[model samples]
Target: MSLKYAVLAALLEGEASGYELSKVFDVSLANFWPATPQQLYRELERLAGDGLIEARTVPQERRPTKRMFSLTAAGREQLAAFAAEPTRRPTAVRDEFLIKMQAMDGVDPRAVRALVEERRAWALGKLARYERVRERLLDGRTEEEYLRDADRVGPYLTLLAGITFERDNARWCERVLTVLGERRAAAGPAGPAALG
Candidate 1:
């Protein structure tokens, strides 16, 4: 999906300045659609020009004037119409890391091990952050309570997906590291080819 649709979905929460929207993307939408601040600002302008969203300028004492945006009726209609469209099939994976993993046999095992360690660290960090978000979303309630009474469920559901993805990543990295480490142990001081 385009940044346009993402922005519109964000505005569905409430009116917000471009800065606030950027923060929202960083928090709630980061799992699905990551956006740079520049991209978000540009999309805000385009959405305004298209009459999908309405903007109001608010004067500030020290900072620059802030423009708060909200979805117009047309924007809601557009989002609803898009939602009605049949879901597309999942896109094919196009990741470079998979290619690197595939070539690990010919490449240096040390480098691949380093990559796995790095990915594991990143995945663990993401899982921690997702847990924090889940806690905040739950507040003092249990999961069942939150799901029953929350105003919106999309963010929580997407966050769950991110958590699951990160868990899988960490698990896969651990498996790769275990295999590589075992080979290194068996080969003693031999080179990568002998380790294989």
Candidate 2:
């Protein structure tokens, strides 16, 4: 999907400045549709130009004026039509880390293990961040309450997918580390060459 749709969907939350939208993308959409602040700002301008969104300049007492954006009726219609489209491309995995893992046999096992360990830590950190977001989204409500009564549940559902993905990633990394450790142990003091 284009960044246009992502911006439109984010505006569904309500009116926000470009800076605010960047933060929203970082906390929420970073998992699936990562965008730099510059990209978002440019998309916002394009969206406004296309009449898909409306922007109003808001004056501040002590700061420069900022433009707040909201989805126009046309933007909503566009988003709805895009959502109704029947076909979507399947997700493809294109990770550099996976490529390195594939070439692990030719590299130092110690180096590969360090990379895997780093990945696991990163995944765990993401999982923790996602959990915090989930809590904040839920507020004081239980999961059942939030899911049943919240006006928008798409964010919550997507957050769940992200949590699951990170959990699975961390688990897979642990398993890989275990297997590599075993192989290294078997290879003994002679090092990775002994494995051959």
Candidate 3:
């Protein structure tokens, strides 16, 4: 998704300065969209120039003035149009490591396993973070609460997807480990897997 739409979606919650929008992007939109602070700031400028967002300088007592941003009518209209459009099919992962794994006969299996292990760990960490955020949001609420407040409901779905994805990655790692173990047991002398 475009940063423009992401910024507009974040501002839909409320008006925010660039710094606040950065935090909002991390906390709220991170599951579906991710952008660095630099990218957010640049997009804010573009949106303001396009008249899609209104910006006003907020004077501060002892600090530099911050430019606060909020969606204008055009911005809201854009978001509405975007929301109404049909979503395309999901894209596949474009990782170069997958290509390397497919041609792994020429490479070291251990190195590929290490890469997979690293990715699994990273995915697990993100899954843990999403779980924490979901717990915080859900609190002790029931399904009724979610049904009532539909605007704040994207996290749980994305969290579930991420958790399942990481869990599958962990399973994949276990299967790979088993295959590697068998290969190691059979090939004793050179241990070609150790090349990595």
TM-score of each: 0.87, 0.91, 0.76
Q: What is the C-alpha lDDT of each candidate?
A: 0.86, 0.90, 0.77
lDDT of 3: 0.77
Better of 2 and 3 by lDDT: 2
Clashing pairs in 3: none
Query: TM-score-based ranking, best first?
Result: 2, 1, 3
Candidate 3, 46: how far from true, in Å? Answer: 1.5
Please report the candidate that would top TM-score against the real structure.
2
Tens-digit lDDT string for candidate 3 (47-112) = 999999999999999998999999999999999898788876474566576676677666677677
At residue 115, candidate 3 shows an lDDT of 78
- Where does the lowest 10-residue lDDT sum fall in candidate 1? 187-196
- RMSD, every candidate, angstroms: 2.3, 1.9, 3.3
Best by lDDT: 2
- Looking at model 2, residue 81 earns an lDDT score of 96
Q: Model 1, 1-196: lDDT tens per residue?
A: 5678889988988899999988878866877778889999999999999999999999999999999999999999998787688866563445688788988886678888899899899889989988998999899999899889999887788788889988999999999999998887787766545434
